[model samples]
Target: MKKIAITIIKFIGFFLGWAILSSILPLSSSENQAIWRLWAEIMPLLAIIAFTFIFWLIEKKNIKLHLFDNPVKGIALGAITGIVWLAFPVLIMYIAKIIDFDGTNSIDLFPVWVLAAFLNVIMQELLVRGYLYQMLKQKHNIVVAAAVTTALFTALHGGAFEAGVIPVLNVLTMSLLMTVVLEYSGSIIAPVIMHFLWNGIGALVLDGVSLADDYPNMLIATFTGNEILSGGICKMEGSMIVLFINVILTALFMFLKNKQGTK
Candidate 1:
């Protein structure tokens, strides 16, 4: 209980610090539309560095920098999981006629967009899966740790609430999936790769114009959007079908992991 409280406090401090730092950064129109644009681009990297340093200080030698014992296998499984996660939702939406590809748009600053996405996922997976979940697991069982981490993960996304109940629930389900990935893989690498792919592909499929409004991508596909099925503010990922698919996939992954362990 004390550890949980400390973790929560640390998270709150981290978020508050990030918000403050982002707010104070100066904007340059030559670079982007607004200060927030630059903030959105760079904040994840800063957060990653900050959190890593803090964790190193707190955990000392116990902090494991290596995300997995088997880097190759972990990375491969993560890639496969990411691809399946993205592909399944798109397939379901296409078949259901919830979305239609209108056309493609040009990507702007492709390299930077990819870097930002990578950093964002690395920071999230490290903090949530590598740090918080691991810390909780020290005192509590895996179920408790995963649940706490998932709840915190869901809460971190401010848009989840505005997107509606389904979106929030979808986020929770995805968080659980990520937790399972981390648990079974015994590494943060799998979840990191999976998360990056999820966000990168999602950005491409949903908005179709850019990785983000601020950062445009060379390859984009415009789609007919339905608020209910397409996720009005939440985008394609917030859809019910996508959530259902994620639940099934997560369960399958867990079952396979358990079977492998027994064998």
Candidate 2:
């Protein structure tokens, strides 16, 4: 009973600590949109990182260590998986006339935004997949750990409970794919790159990806078909096609993990 309570407190405490840090971070009043935007982008990431490393320090784990068994291969595989899987559904959306390319828009702080995005990716990977995952797995099995962390992840991204069913499922399954990458590669490196690539490429290629509105995109696109096909107000994220792709990819990774004789 004590063990379970401690595990639960740590998980909940992580989020609370992050929120407290984020709330207290000082802000300089600036008329510059880019400066303000960049500050907003970096603050939560900074909070997450700051709070997370405290846990790492407490656990006596070095933050410099990369989690992948083979860093080089993990990088390569992560890139491929992120690019290919993302492109697949997009191709289908284009061919099926669910989306159409229009033009492009530029943002004042794109380069900095990209760096922030990378940091955001790395921070999330560490926060969820790092010690939190291992701590849970110590008390339970891998699937339980994965499921719990994935739930927290989805909630953070505004996809769980409050969102519609499809968006919730989209975030849930997408998170599972990342969790699978962590498990299969035996490191968070693969999932980190994979998440960043998906966000980076999608933000560049499509209108409603991670960096939309406040960020620049190479192509301005519009959705025309049914809401489910086009992802409606949620864009490609809520699309049925994306959900199907996620399901397929999740199954594939699970199969691979099983074949590798990894428990």
> Could you estimate the TM-score for every candidate?
0.81, 0.89
Alpha-carbon local distance difference test for all models: 0.70, 0.78
Which ranges of candidate 1 are over 4 A from the true structure?
1-40, 63-66, 205-213, 217-228
Q: After the best TM-score superposition of candidate 1, give how far the Cα of residue 89 lies from its true spot, in angstroms.
A: 1.4
* Model 2 lDDT per residue over 1-263, tens place: 99878878887787788878878887648777556656776787788777777877865773333464788868887998988778888999999988898877766666766775676677778778876787777656787888899988887787434547887888889999998987788778889988988777787547656543565676788888788788887777878898999999889988998999855
Please count the clashing residue pairs in each candidate, in the order shown: 6, 2
Task: For model 2, name the residue pairs that clash.
Answer: 67-187, 103-220
* Residue-level error in angstroms, candidate 2, position 187: 1.2
TM-score of 1: 0.81
Candidate number achieving the greatest lDDT relative to the actual structure: 2
Clashes of 1: 6
Looking at model 1, the pairs that clash are: 106-217, 106-218, 107-217, 107-218, 108-216, 108-217
lDDT of 1 by residue, 148-251 (tens): 87887888775678869888888899899988877678787888888888877667434521235565443333335566676654656567777787799899
